[model samples]
Target: MSTTPPRLTTASGIPVADHQNSLSAGRRGPLLLQDFHLIEKLQHFNRERIPERVVHAKGSGAYGSFTVTHDITRYTSAKLFAQVGQATETFVRFSTVGGERGSADTERDPRGFALRFYTEDGNWDLVGNNTPMFFIKDPIKFPDFVHTQKRDPQTNLKSAQMMWDFWSHAPESLHQVTMLFSDRGTPDGYRHMDGFGSHTYSLINAAGERVWVKWHLKTQQGIKNLMADEAARLAGTDPDHAQRDLFEAIARGDFPRWNVYIQVMTEAQADTWEQRTGWNPFDLTKVWPHADCPRIPVGVVTLNRNPDNYHAEVEQAAFSPANLVPGMGYSPDKMLQGRLFAYHDAQLYRVGTNHQHLPVNRARCPFHHQQRDGAMAIANGGAAPNYETVNAAGTAPSGFGHGDPGWALHGVAGRYDERGESDDFTQAGNLFRLMPPDAQDRLTTNIAHAMQHVSDDVQQLQIGHFTKADPAYGAAVRRKLADLREG
Candidate 1:
């Protein structure tokens, strides 16, 4: 017998011919169900689309590797960094946070910078955003906060009225709101923007020592942003500009990279700072100033390969804050806690109950768990029962080992709402003051242009909030928008 491969066929191995054309009456008449080929093609085509992600809906991703350049063994005992010069295969997705699955890639919104590292121990996913802080710290308001960013239910159109109304009442949003209206909001593309964990995470060592840390992935390409005019034109001319840029760059061997850094604060330092300065270390809406705690470079992540199949690799990729490897752990940040639950739940809804079985989200190394059966469970679970605690089967160390390292907890638990000592306006003011004069002019003008679309009352209210951030900020915005007539 010849060594040639089996004959090519359709998914059911029913052998296909003339795939380029559908079965029709004289190649133009209505097709018949007897044409199995045509029926099969149409059936698959109808089911090609799946439910889109609820957030970070519009995105682009690539496959890559993260090589550890520096040893951070003192900070974490995770096996991924146990040896020097260790490299972990990674998948990273960059996305626009507030838009729908079909929204323009160039929208002036925060981008999701989520990374999944297939380490020897387990899959470690760091899901974050382009900006270092967020609009709210409390988890209770998160749903409403996101709703305001989304389309109004009745009109099904993005509403500035809803966004401004909610944000005006919650002054904590002033910091992020200011950043969103600035030129940096419309980044040139995914490659040129910075990424941050936003919330503080904990790191524990082999010796059980723990420290609070915030992860920052500074773009090696440097920060580049688009002006309102350039972004608007590109959105219409090439809505997929960022996605195409990433794919073409990687194909041309021009890999994009980012230098990963961590701002570490020791437990002693946290206690001392809290006692002396009264600042909560776990506040999600504020940043730990570089002056207070400097960034220590950890490693570099370079994306050198684009996904072969976008839907299988990129769209189905699932990431969550709960996918913690040893040495890395969670914090008490309420928003982070909420996301720990929300992200996985969303993945289940969007990608199926056994979404982790997909190649993009699957662990590279062997993983044995009693997770058993769910819809679309493709992996072989063997003859073992899905439930745990079987005396006969016997458990032998599996599933990321065990729970995270312990940390002391205090204070009486009750219905208590506490505030961090840091002011929202200080950082926002700092950001505004750092911009070059022309950039400041552009930011003011951009805010004026967007505010003109909103009602005058809302515009005045937002201007007042900007005034609270800084007198110059408020005055500049007001000066630019004065030409708009109030009816």
Candidate 2:
């Protein structure tokens, strides 16, 4: 017998009939509700579109595996990294922030680097961005900052004035703003870019010792980016260029890879490292200089398989910082703390409440839960207890309780929004100074072109931040903008 799946059928398992035509009173007359097939098609079509993500809506994803090549059990005892030569299946979604699903691939926006690892224990989602820092360190300002990047309320169009207005007022945004308006901003495609977990997270070892860590996925493909003109040309001609590039690469067996590395700081080192470096270690708006904390090589992640279906795998794929397996823990960083909640809540709204059950997001390891029924409940916990009790004998020792490791904590809880104490300008200045002269010129030119549409006052205010980063940096941008205005 030829073993094959049956022919195409309706969603309710009924074979479709005359799919090309709609049931009507007569030809081109009012449709009849009794035609269940037509009614089902229209209803499903109407509800097909779920809400697009507020950020990182324009994205591409792939299936891959991460092989642990180094011993990192001293830093984190997470099962995926427990031993050298161990491999874990992973799903990665690369996205452009501040754009709709139909937006251009080459737009100068931060590329989101979200990774979901299907380890032996469970799933661990490390959702991050291309840059090592963010525009705002506090979650309270996130919504406001995103609003500036989004469409203007009245015009329903992107306004440079809105973007610069927020960045100019927020001096702490300088580091990320500088990075965003540079040559690296317009990466050639997803393959030629680096990925970073922007926030500092804690990792606990088998000994129960905790340390702060930062993840870096340096592209093995090496860095390649499009010039502004070329980016604009491609944006118009081939909006799905990056998506096509990644998909075609894996299809032809030319797999893309990234070298995963992590920088670790002990709890004792975290206490006074800021005093030594003249910067806060936990600040999401800044990066720890590699000289201060060098990255230790961990593993190599390669995307060897292209996803079978885009909508079923990529679009439904959800990632959250809260999805941590054992041997991983949280940190006191306010941004990290906020994301621990924000990411989960965002997924709940964007994907359904049972998003965790989706294949891409679901854990490969056996998992049981009291999380019963709701919309899209693939597994309804049939005949199982829905509540936790001693007699119920819940999912073993875990029992819906998280023993997420322990750390030393002693602090007075209060509103700590004051950013003046943190030195934000020095690092940005250092980055600018470190750039080659040609890179510097490109950076300034990029900034000027992007800022040309904004008001002069907004331009001047943003220039002040550039000026604060480096006198030469600010002067170059000013001159470039002047030349543009004259033309």
Candidate 3:
């Protein structure tokens, strides 16, 4: 029997005989830069890390499939929802929004629930959170809000003062702040909580009719949370508790799953929803009540496979709301629009110019584009034609639609003040009232304890916003704090 000799080659395809020894002036002399192999290896290692995410720095992911359980093909022409039993490959990542890679898994913070669907059309990424609503609606306030959640520059520590200061100034945060302080903020693990597509998106049917929509993923394991005290204890005992829970549970053949559902609104209804609710339909800080827009079950997503390499499959796995399929489109939600640009730009910086070429982020379907070559080019597009004729038909289906519907815009381009124009308090106030009595009590007590270290000036200012949301809300929180001071 004959076998081919083992081959060794450099990145440029040059055959190499010795990779261990580098060329030097002598056996004991200084090495030479002309040693292309050594220089290349060292240079690549020097640039190994791009940059950790400004948010969602720590995360875990799993391989899964989405099986459509119910179909509403009339609502969306998206291939993923085209049939009642269609199954699509998926990847879901759960993360702590403000924590570093080594932060405690039990941190009382909103969790990131990012889903990537490898549909026949392309990858449709529904990058969302475990909560249905967010802290702020406007994209401009995001950087400032996150800054307060992160460590203080001077002290290099997480500062309650910074967090409270920002919340007091931004009244829109009351709803999310209330949610964060409650039991739900400290989720038991990644498997026991629901997820939300927080931003409103558009669905275009085959006929080109557009409707606003939101997605939800209800966990099959049922909702479970750690109380404030339990969370604190777990934080000290096991920082990787959630990560281990997900991996171990999957390894035991007990796959975690979620029931996918969507709430949709017709264009005509969207026109009047703002007036009806006193909140913008596209606002990220609010949610369309299920009573008004009942959830229509669409599918079930089951995570059956755990990642073999966390760094390659999870750390470098990029998901973006901008990754929309043909029949799906974007709404005018400012935060979602800002993210469409930010997420891809962030991936390019954090991973590489050709980050999409990675096996995890790459498209499943044969995708053709003019993009090619960068720091890690896959052979620089080989000998393919770099230029094509001016026309290759339209980018959309035959006579269906080309892009997102062109809605009319008439506002003057200026920094328009939204204080009087927008109703930020009503929704948050209603959320407080809707909570059960016991939950409301826990929420206030949690706030009081967390604010014990906060300054009076900031505390007073913050409570004032809660007061506007509900007098009872403000009074309960104030009473708790007063007792703490007296004791």
Candidate 4:
């Protein structure tokens, strides 16, 4: 092998004559158009950035492996979980939901926990958040809800009034509103918080029997959170605190791990679960009671390697709930159903149509598709037929299999309002009542601090929802708001 340094060259492999200076007609005159290398460099730099994610704009990611610790074949036939001690290559990205790409890592927002498992069957993407529940249950309310979290269109600033007003009107948001005001909203960093497949999903066994399941990842490092004041201080002092912590910890070989568990409910149980608990089992805003459906250990996820290039690996890595292996399937969760379409569409627009050809997203197992050319078609099906008709043999691809088992659906096909259909406050009240006295104090105090700048009418309306959840809960918030206003 040659020991000499490699020569610098243009993208087309022509040796670069001079990289430091642009080719010019004279020493200080106009730059020459014939300078192909200079033009190439400038053009690439101009398009260097793809559009940032509308949500989860700021994030940190690492390559990891998930080792199956227990047998779950009785529940799912996914090859990655086929046997005990099986390990699957994985990539995990942790992110803050509402912040911009340059926003502070310590912002009081729900953290995104998106995991991708490269199984022999295909890539299984489990996209979720640190919390088990979300602000809304349906997709139609999603854009409006996100609008509240974002800047006010007229003022170009985040408005507390907007958030409060929206939440007051959408009483369903009370559950996640309670959570957001709690310490969990301001996690210490990426390594210390739990992750959940907040949406309910389905698991199909070899026998083709289906069961509803929710995924959970409990951090092995244990839960740690920052106080509101401390989080604010760090946001100003070190905006990239969480990103830095994750990279440094992995660099120093102190890899973070999470024990993966899933709560399973049978089709029979799912049918009556809502009727019994007064909570829709498929509601994204609700959580399955642990007492009713216990967490069963499945595996351990250990993130051991940090990405070498943030943009290439971390930023470009796209995950969708739609990317599921054979055993895994979707549920009737409205938020999840909406995400199934939105996530892939976002990637197609942001990352180009051939994003799956990108190294970070490419499937490990052999994949054959009739999908033809699009922008940046890196690996167009070379020489092979792009249509199924050319096969003549009429045999489908190896990995291709029958679709998921279907379930009965009975509902009027109309825009039915869910606000009055479900008992939203009971669960929110339960969560508030579950907190200890000090935690309850902190929760109310946090809510009051956030509501300080909101309109009185909006505040009163929100307080009423809280009161319905638990009278003491609303009373404490009302008192705290009063104290804040007076002082």
lDDT of each: 0.85, 0.88, 0.88, 0.93
What is the total number of backbone clashes in candidate 4?
A: 0
Model 1 residue pairs with clashes: none
Q: RMSD per prediction, one decimal? A: 3.6, 2.7, 3.3, 2.3
Per-residue lDDT for 9 in model 4? 95
Error of 3 at 183 (Å): 0.8
lDDT assessment of candidate 2: 0.88
Sorted on lDDT, best first, the list reads 4, 3, 2, 1
Candidate 2's TM-score: 0.95
| TM per prediction | 0.90, 0.95, 0.91, 0.96
Which model, 1 or 2, shows the larger lDDT? 2
For residues 42-114, could you state the per-residue lDDT of candidate 3 as single tens digits? 8988976657789999898999999999978888888889888889999999999998888999999999999
Task: State the local distance difference test value for candidate 3.
Answer: 0.88
Which scores higher on lDDT, 2 or 4? 4
lDDT at residue 373 of model 2 (Cα atoms): 85
lDDT of 2 by residue, 1-487 (tens): 9899677668979887777887899987998889888888789999888788899998999999999999998887788887899999999999999999999999999999999899888999989998999988888999999999999999999988999999998988999988887888999999999999888988877766778999999999999998889999999999988999999999999999999999988878889987887667888998988887899999999998888988879988888898889888777778888988888888889889999998888899999899988899997789988987776655555312344455556778787765667777887888898889988999999889889988999999888888988999889989999999999
Strongest candidate by lDDT: 4
Which residues of candidate 1, in runs, are more than 4 Å off? 1-8, 16-39, 272-278, 390-404, 418-422
TM-score top scorer: 4
Q: Which ten residues in a row have the lowest lDDT in candidate 2?
A: 397-406
